[model samples]
Structure formats: structure tokens, C-alpha cells
Target: MTTFSRRKALALAGAVALATGLAAATPVLAQDCEKVDLTFTFWGSVNEKNDIENAVKNWNTNNPCIQVKPMHIPATGTNYVQKLTTMIASNTAPDIGYLGENQAFQWATEGKILDLSPYMGETPDQQYIKSTIYKAGDTLMGTGLATGVMLIYYNKDVFDAAGVPYPPAKADEAWTWQQFVDNAKLLTKDRSGKNATDPAFDPNAIDTFGVTLPSWWGGWYPYVMSNGGQFANEDGTALTLNSPEAVEALQGFQDLIYVDHVMPNPTQTSSLPTGDVLMQSRKVAMSMDGMWRVTDFAKLGINWGVGVLPKWKTAETVVLSVPKVIFSQTKHPKEAYEFYKYISDPAQVGLFKSGLWAPHEKAYFTEPDLLKTWVQAEGSAYPPEAMDAIVDYTLNHAPQQAPVYQLKNIGQIMSEAVEPNIQQIMNNKATAQDAMDKAVATAQPMMQGRW
Candidate 1:
């Protein structure tokens, strides 16, 4: 029943607003006397930490009534969910926190996250892009967390040097999967100057790879999506990993290695850094990657050009976005809702958007130069058309797949069971079909017990 006033919350986020030209301190009224404290938990590196702290400072400066503290938990891998779940069980949960697109829905279904439908109503949903939020059921309006969009990144200098054409600035001309594979085959070469398809090509003596696929869950999303595979049924109850579409998708992904022979083997790939795949000595011509590539890898002296992900049956890619959820156990739901409204304002949203995190709102997409300016202000790492391609790809082709789990413990169980299978497929130790089949068999027991 304790509420942090809206005006106070605005003052609290002043630093964030100021950075985006909305930072003026708001007047604090006498009614702002409540001793309110809220904790925000999220995962990030030092630079990302600074960006978030700056946002929190802005909020504190403008709002004198509420005291908000930010907590950084190093949840490398699935530890984020593990630690947070422990906190919730003990009723020591933060008032508001970030949740992944899928994990958010699982938490929400467990009654851990507050339902914002009453708070959001039609106006907020109107501004929301359907692809950003996860849905639990067909008619359920909002039950999920954040979304991320996938993109193709090509080394422009490498392309130009190899005499291959660059990806177009817009999605309308984006290459299909076949074109992408052909380009990869063309760019892949050994020291003796043989492409992947050349009879003279030698895999053992290869010096450059056509592309790099991260051996993680992220890689599977595009493969399955591009091949017209659905990870789960529309209703989110049954597993769909054995479908022909999923098998086809897996075959396509595996083809990058076993069939096309353009990608590096899993052993060599495990040594790669998070975003610097293009920085390898045996040059990488392209990478199926995330938008974070611009902010994370642009400064590495690689001439990278981004394009919409190559299409298969349809031009689709997976998007990962986070949502800030209010705890159902919070003492001040109204005040928390007020904070949500205050921080999500366009000006504040713009600051977060500029910092490599995509905003959930739609207005940010229309500003063609917004993404380019944000990344360039730090340094000119990506090519000029990077933002154009990302925005075009996300707006036109990104579709939302629910990230929710069927059972309460499903988050931990699925992460544990699936990551290794992903590793197995990426390493070619097992076929995508074989790996996924084992994964389903393992997870089915857990889901049945929980759902």
C-alpha cells in the first residue's frame, strides 16, 4: 500500500532523461514523503553497467521521494534464473527486474511477475510491436518478456577484396539462404586459394571461413526459423522438435559445416570470443549474429556490413528482447506501475535504445539514424548502413515466438538439457535431429511433471 509518487519517480530517472534531452529535474511536492525503496536486477558487463547506472542516477536525481538501488548479478549461462528463482522462493525478490523473452513468461505464469494489462491497456499495446513481447496463449494479451532480432553481418572489406558484392542497404533486396550459402562458399578459401566447392579445396589447410555460428541457443533460432520449423506448438503445450520442418532446419544449419564445409569445426569455434568472430586471422566473411554486434564488435577494426537474415521458406529471424516486470508481491503496485510508465517514456526509452538495448516501443524504429548515431558516438566501427539493415530486418521480418516454459522448474531444466544438445549439433557429434530428439525426451518428463 506504500506508493512512490509518479512525479517523484520522474525525478529519480532525471539522469536518464537528461542524457536524452528529458533530464530536467521535476518539482517534488510535499505529498512525496513515503520512504520507498526498490531494487532492479539485470546482467551486463562494465560498460553496460555504466549505461544502466547512468539511467538509474537520472531517475534518482529527479525523484527525491523514492530510493532505488540497482543490483548486478553475474548469471553467466543459466545462473541468472537460478539465483533469481531462489530469491523469489524466499520472498526476497526485487520490486522490478529484467526478464528474458521466454523466462519472463515462465515467471509471469508462476505469479511472480505482475500483470500489466490493467496498467498498459490499449494505449501502450498500440505503441508495442507484437514481435517484442511473448504471449502465453493465443488470446492472452501479455504474458511474456523481452525479444531480440537476429541479423547477418558481412565483412565489407573482405567482400570487396574478394570481389563479391555487398548486401543491400534494405531488406527488399536481402539475399535468400541459397545466395548466402553461395557467397559463403565463394568467400571461404584455403591457403592455396581454393573455395569450399573447388576440387582443389583442402579443409585441413583452410585459412578463412565463410561464416561463424555461435554454438549456443541463439544459433538454433535462425536455423529453425529459416527452415520453417517451430520450436513448440502454437499453444505452448507440446514439443515440436521432431517435425519435418525442424529436421529440415537442422539439416540446413548442419550443412554450413558438414555439407558446405565453409564453417569451422566445433573445437576451433569454442575458442571464439563473444562478438569478435570477424577478428580472426583466418578471416570470417560473414556471421549470423545479433544487433549487439554493432555495439560490441564494431570497434575491432573489421569493416562489417549488416543485412537482414537470409530467408528460407520465409524471411524470418529470431529477436531477443527483455521486459521490465513488476513483482506481484510488491507493496506498491501502483507506484511500481508509475515507475514503469516514467522510465518507458520516449526520451528515456531512446537513451536505452542508443545503448545497444532495443526499446520495446515502436517510435524508436522510425528514426532511421537513431541506431547509427548511438553506435557511432562511441566510435565508427560498423559500416554506415548497419542501422538501416537492422531496423529494416526487425521491423519487416522479426516475429515473436513465446519464450515461456510449461512448468515452474522448466526454465532450469530446459536450459540444462538443451545447451549441451546445441553443443553436440554444432560440433557435429550428433545430428540436429538426434540431438533435439534426446533433448525432447529429457525435457518431456520434467515438463509433464510440472505442467
Candidate 2:
């Protein structure tokens, strides 16, 4: 439960002492009788780190023969990758670690990570959500540590003050893009108490924005898919960012800031706090964000509600997670897999109750009792409507694999082409079509085929 800074120093010292102790002890007659040490590396918030450390402590206490050390890496995204890569290069990779979906595939292809197929068994997909299982051809790389899906989080007080009806919870009853925009307009008000629909409404002096459209892929990708767009073709051999469907969806989001004026622009949004804070303070009426925000919203004590995302041709969302994988260089594969299984289980970890993660196993969705263990659990913090808005929608309406899971070299593509051009489009410096066309040109050559 210690902070990362203190935990890092203590872990290193304990590892050194453990190594010395084992080296000085009399040689054990059987390999099974000898003590085994395994390291698990991961990156996340302080709460998540504490949760994992507690799990490791419990495992170590219960299993004296196989002691697991928790290695806390307090970095995420590219920085995490950089540190992990340095460890691998120095031949000091942990037995297992949390890896981004894109990097998991890339590493699996390079044989840097172990194929977990033998441990998970044939038809691993039968146990886990098919989308969350990472593979290179037939070789299973790893499974998601947990699953996450996007949802429309709105401030009930804001909608009530504007006399606007709440958005629908079920996918079948989802609002159309136009209807969503119309509602957003009604909720958007200027400092003079004029809604966006009012002719006298001043955009320059807005008191509250109707929405905060996410510029990140997790926020916008669902809309693109719902509009019948694909980031790449099924084979993942080419970039399809310039497709008509993609152009339309991206433009529609941009229009929210420019033409509709219901959303804040890049500069304006940068000055605002995160989505959860935005809703709590009523600075924005609604936000399209990951369900993980439930933890923050619950603590903020905001009067909030969950709703299915608005649809274009279909109501769709993306489910994703960072996978925990066993390294190829591990000296104790058996012990590593054991700890991996222990930590990945929702029932074993405390993350589910904090609303930071969802169960990755298919049974959690299909089995009523298992579903209630997390969704309806006392400290879960999920809104009442989450059963329909998130769980049901994800199980029935959402695509199994998000673009990040399907596309190869996605991290590079996002950095080199997608992110930069998308920012330009959001800034109103370029049109969606023009920006995507430019992005596609740069990303096409980087496509190395999907996993």
C-alpha cells in the first residue's frame, strides 16, 4: 500500500536481500522445494499500484515456495514502453508486465514475449472475451487485464436545470446524431442565460458547454465505427482514414466545436479540468469518456447518469484494455503464469470495486451471479443505468476488437499521422477530409499487416 517512490526503493532492497539469502542457503535436493522469485511489473495510478501490491503480498504470504515481487513502474504510454524496452535490452525484464495492446502484438511478433497458449489452453477465446485475447497468427500472446468501454456521462443537474430530458440508456433507444446535437444545443447556455438555440446567444461568453468531445481515439473511434468507417480494412494492410464514412464522422465531431458550438475548442478545452471535474462543476453538460470515470465521479459526489452513445447508422462502442504478458526471458514460466492468473482475476483484485476496470472474462457478462459480484457490488460505484448503458451495450452492441487491437504498428501510426492531423482538424486549421487525406498518405507505408 506504499506510494511508488517508497515502494520502488523497498522492493529493490528486498530483491537484493532475497537473492543473497537464496545464494547463501544450503542447496535444495529438488527444484520444486527450492524457493522461486518472480517479478511483476506494471504501470497505473497510485491506487491501482497499491491494489496490485496488496495482491502480491497476499499471494506471497499464501505461497511461500513461489515468492512474487511487485515491481512498480510509475509511467504510462510511451514512457512506460521506453523503460520496459531498456529493461529487456539489459536482460533484466520482469517475468511478466502490463503491455499496451499494440506493443503486445509487436513484441509477440518479434518473439520478445512468450506465447501463453499452453497455459491458457486451446480455445482461450471461450473463456475470455475474444477481442481481449492478443495473438500473432495462432500463438496466444496474452489476455486483457480488464476490459473498458466508452459511455456518455452526463450531469443530471445540468440537464434538469435546462429542462432537458435525459439521454437514453439502452442501445435500441439511443439518440441519433442530430437528436444528440439538438439536445446539446438546448443544454448549452451563455453567461446571459441564453441557450445555444437562442438567436442572441453569444459563443464568446459561454457559461456552460453542452459537451466535451474527446480528441483521443477512445472517444472518437466508436463514432467512426458506428458511421460504418474502418481505421484500416479487415486485413489491416492499408490506412482507410480518408474513407467517406471516416471523413463524415470526424467532420461531425469537428462541427460540434465549430458549426454547432456545443463543444469547446482545443484551446478552450485545454484550460478546463478533466471530464469528471467538468461534469462535477457543471462546466460541461456531458462528456464522452471511458466508464473508468465512475470512480472519480463517485468520489466527487456529482448527480450523474450513464447513457448509450448516440448513433449514426448504428449504436456502437469500443472495448479495450492493456494486456499482462509473460516475458520470453522468464526463468520461471510456471510461477509467472500462476501469478498472472491470480492477479488478472476480478474476484482476486480490488480494482473492480474502484470502477477502474471491468471483468475481462466472458462468464462475468453471461452469468448473472458473476455479473452482480462487480456491477451490483456495494462499493462498485457504477450508476444504476450502467447495467444497460455499459454492460448490456458492450456485450450485445459493441464490436469485439477496437482499432488498437486490430491494427499493427498503431502506436507509430498514431504519433506520425493520425494524432497530428486530427489535432489540426480539431483546431479548425484544416478540414477532416483534408487532414485525413494527409494522414492516410503518411500512414499507408507504415502499415505492416495486422496480427
- The candidate that wins on TM-score is 2
Clashes of each: 23, 0
For every candidate in turn, the CA RMSD to the true structure comes to 6.1, 8.4
For each candidate, what is the lDDT? 0.62, 0.79
lDDT of model 2 at residue 318? Answer: 86
Best by lDDT: 2
Model 2 lDDT on a 0 to 1 scale: 0.79
- The sequence of per-residue lDDT tens digits that candidate 1 reaches over residues 81-155 is 788888888988887777765577666666777776665543334445555544444222242222346776777
Off by over 4 Å in 2: 1-35, 64-67, 71-77
lDDT of 2 by residue, 1-451 (tens): 1224323433454211111011111222244677898888888766567767887887776677778888888774578888889999999988988987768877888888998877666643655554777877766876777787888989999999999989899999999999999999999999999999999999998889999878989878888899999998878888897999989999999999999889999999878888778888888999988876666676778799989999999998888788779999999997777777666655555567677778776656766555655777667878889999978887888864777777778889988989999999999999999999999999988988776
| Model 2: how far residue 238 lies from native, Å | 2.3
Residue 73 CA displacement from its true place in model 2, Å = 3.5
> Per-candidate TM vs. native?
0.78, 0.87
